[model samples]
Structure formats: C-alpha cells, structure tokens
Target: MTPDTTAPTLALLLVDLQNAYFEAPALAGVRESLIERANELVRAARAAGRPVVLVRTEHARDRSTWTINMRADGEGFAFRGTEQAAYVSTLERAGAIDVVKTRDDAFHGTRLREVLSGLGVSQLLIGGVSTHSCVAETAMAAFAHDYRVAIAGEAVASENGSLAAAMLDFLTEELRQPVLDHAASLRLLQGPLDAR
Candidate 1:
C-alpha cells in the first residue's frame, strides 16, 4: 500500500547531513548528489512555507555520551562544538530549526516532535545519510508517532548501494511507505497540504 499523502500540514526532516558523515570514504561517491537533492527539497519547503528541520548527531567530547559499542570502538563521534560535527557547508541552513541528537532516532531526547507539533506538521518528508541506520530509525519512529512519513529516494544515501537498496525495499515494499524522488518530493511538499 502507498502512504496516505493527505495531511493538513507537513515538514521536511533532514537527518545527519553533517561534515563528519559526508567525509567518510564510503559516502564520497554519492555525497555531492545527495546534498544537491537535499538542497532542492529545502528550497521547495521554503517556497511552500513549510518548516525544514536539520537534525545532527553530537555527543560529549569525553565520549561519555557515546553508545557502548561506539565507545568501545574508541572512535570519537560528532562531538559538540567541533568542526567535524558542523553541518556540511553546501546545504542551506538559514531559518531551519536545528536539532542536536545523541542517538540514531531524531525523536529520541530531542525537540523534533515539539517543533513539528508547533508547526502543525502531521506529515514529514525525510532524507539524509546512512540509509540503513539513522534514516531508517527515524522513519520507523515517525510512523509509530502517527505522523505520515515519506522518504525522499534520491536525497538519502548510504555507505553502500546494497544497504541503501535494502532499506528502500523494506520501507517501500514491506512497510508500504512512499519513497519519492527529489522532483516528486518537491511537488508533494510545495503543493497545497489541505487533506483530500
């Protein structure tokens, strides 16, 4: 089944488009294109007077906030106030609501829901990096929260094509969520949001 597209309000949720994630070699090939597509979504959202929420992952410097495996791996993640944790330079962030998250799900311990509620956003268009992890988790959480969710197919990317494809299949085929391309997303987001 296709996602029900009728909603009174909608917003765009951009997951983990930070410098650190973009710098990973695994994401290098698709990074530029993904950002471009995301920019298009941002532009469309702005034109339609919808909120564009920017969600990034940032933990404490001492790694105290890190998850068990992450801490065990001895690798520092997006530490707060660090350049590595900053949003990538290319994408437009002005007027966007910034949400700092410590976990994969953007809603966990974050004001994302509150922000959406304030905007009367009953539907969310999600796209960003690591298709199998953070993006997938956020999609599930949004669905559970009773918000209509759609994934921007071309705007999100993973470390590998296989992982991206797998997540897309699960979300679209298994879960029956809508997976829209950048152009389709633009039309959906920019069009009238009054429920049909």
Candidate 2:
C-alpha cells in the first residue's frame, strides 16, 4: 500500500550503521555500495520531511556481556565513544535522532519505540547494515507494533548476500510489506499521501 502523504508521518530507522560494522572484513564486499545506498535513503527521507533515526550498537569495553569477536582479517568491534562507533560523514546528522542500542533489536531496552510513537509515526522506512540481523529484527518489530513498514531494497546488506535476499523476499512476500527502491520511496513520500 502506498503511504498517505497528507497524514503519513514516517520514521526512517537506520539500523546499526556504525564504523565497526562497515569496516568489518566480512562486509568488505558490499561496504561501499551499502553506504552509498544508505546515504540515498537518508537524502530521500530528509527531502520528504520525514523523521530520521540513527541507531548504533554500543558495547562496553570490558566484554562482560555479549562478546563481539571480529574476524582475523576484520577490524574488531569498538565500544561507544570510540571513532569506530561514529556515523559516516557523508550522512547528515542535523534533525536526526541518535539512538544508542546495546542489542540487535532497536526496540529492546531502547527508547526507539516510544520516540516513534510520540512522533505519531504511522509508517517506518528501514535501512542500514546487517540485513539479516539488526535490520530484519527491527523491521519485524515495527510490523508487530502495527506500523506500515517499508524496507529500502538497496539500502540494506548482510555479510551473506543470499541471506539478505531471502530476508528481503520474506518481508515483501510473506509479510506483505513493501520493499521499495530509493527512487520509488522518495516519490511516494514527496507526493500527496492521501490514497489515490
């Protein structure tokens, strides 16, 4: 279903687009392209006057909780307040809500759900790293909460391309969610939101 522009308030959820995830050797193959697509989504959301949320994964340095083991050839995980935890410079931070999450699911122990609800966000546009993990989890959570969820096809990636494709397919086919390209999403948001 197309979003209703007149009453459609969208929240762009950027999942775990941190430096460590991007710099990981396991994701090297699609890192650059993924970043580009994510940036495109951000630009589109901004032009449409949608609320943009930046979610980052933060872990304590002591490794007391879940241990993040970086691949031998990969740049290991970095804790919060480190350079590797910062968002890329290409993306604009103005008017964006920065949510620091400790877990894969953005809703778990985070103020994300409340923040979106407070903003009266009826639709959610999802994009970011680890298509099969964080992005998938957050998208599903948004669905469970009865929000109209749209997954930006090119803006999501996983270490395994096949896994990402399968998850995207599930969200589109089985879940009946819209997985749109950057251009289509931009146009939908820019146009009148009332049903045509």
Candidate 3:
C-alpha cells in the first residue's frame, strides 16, 4: 500500500475590501497596504488557476436587512446601492465569484460554503479587512466547516490593531492554523496548500 495524496484544492478568500471600511478616516492608514497585500494574493491565485472568492458585506436601505447595532444606531453603511458596498477600485476582482454577507461570519447567511464546496475548495488562503470581526469570524467558520485555513497577516486590517493581533494569535495558536506573510502566501499558492 502507498500513501495517497489528494490534489490541492485551495481558494483565495478576500473579504470586506470595500469602500465602507477603507473610506473611513480612522482606517485610511491601513487601506493602501492592506489592499496591496491582498491583491498580491489575488494575482497569485489567478496565475495559479485557483478560484478567488469575494466576500463582501451589504445591507438594504429599508432597515429590513440591518443588523441590531445598525438598527440601534439608526444608520447603516454599505447599503446595496451605495458606493460603500462596492469593492475598491484597486482590488483584483475580475472573474471572481462574489458572495454577499450581512453578518460578520461570511458563511452564516451566505452561499459562501456552498460556493467553496462547488468549487471543490478544501483549503482557504484568506485576506481582507477588519481582522477582528469579519476576517476572524469567517476563519472560525471555515475551521468549523473543516476547511484548512491560512491568513495573510499584512492583508488583514482592523480598526483596533490589538484586537487584530489577538485574533491572529488565536487562529494561529489555538486553532492550529497558519498566519502567513505576503511572500509565503504567494508561495503557498504556487506550490502546496500546506506550504509555509
């Protein structure tokens, strides 16, 4: 008998790289670097013939789809027709599969899991904004769904740096996942899914 290996099935998941977060003055500093790093993953994924999934947050203006916090605040960002909901102009989004999520967890109320399943994506190399919220929740949900997960540290931004650090630590240490840098993530796409 011989050890059999399955072909690597990986997708690059880019989340919440929309104007809603990046346009915020408080997050402006991270916008440029984060998008650049994430776009690196996007380009590598495309060159490697891997699927790139865009997970973005959007809401309805009628208050029907607003979260509790949004409702309480009597306002919302990223409403469907708003420019805030649109992906940033610099992001590499051509030919990517799009999934709209209303909550922090991309898989919770969206077709993200099904999209991944349909694409036969057994592993995910994740990048994007708000590392402590949408990014963290999506990673945790992917873990729960038994998908191997990796994060590109520089590609994920947050309103709070400390919280982002904590979430990365939890994902790397507690969840036994890899938190990779931009170069390493490109290598992972070029070679094996488990490559460091």
TM-score of every prediction relative to native: 0.91, 0.83, 0.92
RMSD of 3: 3.9
lDDT of 3 by residue, 61-129 (tens): 888888899999999889997899999989888989999999999998888987877776788988888
Better of 1 and 2 by TM-score: 1
Clash-forming residue pairs, model 3: none
Residue-level lDDT tens digits of model 2 in 75-134: 335576797778766656788898888767888889887777666677788889888889
* Candidate 1 residue lDDT tens string, 58-87: 999787778878888988778888887999
Residue pairs with backbone overlap in model 1: none
Candidate that beats the other on TM-score, 2 or 3, i.e. the better one: 3
Whole-model lDDT per candidate: 0.85, 0.75, 0.85
Evaluated against the true structure, the overall lDDT of model 3 is: 0.85
Give candidate 2 misplaced runs (Cα > 4 Å): 1-8, 64-76, 193-196
